[model samples]
Target: MATQTANALRFLSMDTVQAANSGHPGAPMGMADIADVLWREFLRHNPKNPKFANRDRF
Candidate 1:
């Protein structure tokens, strides 16, 4: 699951950068694993309403 999540993040970031033709992809690619762990273990936010008050961001 973690590996899948990391791969998803990496590809998504790369795709976004490619589509926009801007921004740095290295940051997202490098942090994919960390992001996967955090999203799966530490961070907490409402997927339906991410900006909701009292919910953790990032």
Candidate 2:
């Protein structure tokens, strides 16, 4: 599970930087765990259905 998330994060970071054509993807790419924790833990959401209108997407 953790490995899958890590790989997904790498692809996401790379894609985002590639799309924007600016900023540093490397930093976020390296700090995926911290990003994951902040988003998956501290951030608010509806666990049952995160896509629900009232929930924050990220």
Candidate 3:
């Protein structure tokens, strides 16, 4: 699941760069796994209310 999540992030990041025809893709690709693990295990925020006062701000 974690690997899948990481790959999905990488793909989306790459796609965004490709669509824009600009920006560096290496950072996103490299950070994908770390971001996935952090989000899954450590980060806490509300998807429905991203700016909630009590939510962790990354």
Candidate 4:
């Protein structure tokens, strides 16, 4: 599942670069797994209200 997630992320980056005709894919492709894990485990958000004006989004 993790492998699939990373592959999907890489694929998305590839598609994005192709569409935009700019940006480098190496970083996004190589760091997908790390980024995925970080985002999944550490990222915080409120889909109901993204701008709560209290939580530091940084």
**Which candidate, 2 or 4, would have the higher TM-score against the true structure?**
4
Name the better of 3 and 4 by TM-score: 3
How many steric clashes between backbone atoms does each model show?
A: 0, 0, 0, 0
**TM-score between model 3 and native:** 0.82
- Candidate 2 TM-score versus the reference: 0.60
Per-residue lDDT of model 4, residues 1-58, tens digit only? 7789989999999999999999999999999999778656676766798887664353
Task: Report the C-alpha lDDT of model 2 over 16-48, residue by residue, as the tens digit.
Answer: 999999888888788887767777678778778
Clashing pairs in 3: none
* lDDT of every predicted structure (CA atoms): 0.91, 0.79, 0.92, 0.85
The CA-based lDDT of model 2 is what? 0.79
Model 4 misplacement above 4 A:
45-58
Better model by TM-score: candidate 2 vs candidate 3: 3
lDDT of 1 by residue, 6-56 (tens): 999999999999999999999999999999899878887778997888887
**Candidate 4 weakest ten by summed lDDT:** 49-58
Better model by lDDT: candidate 2 vs candidate 4:
4
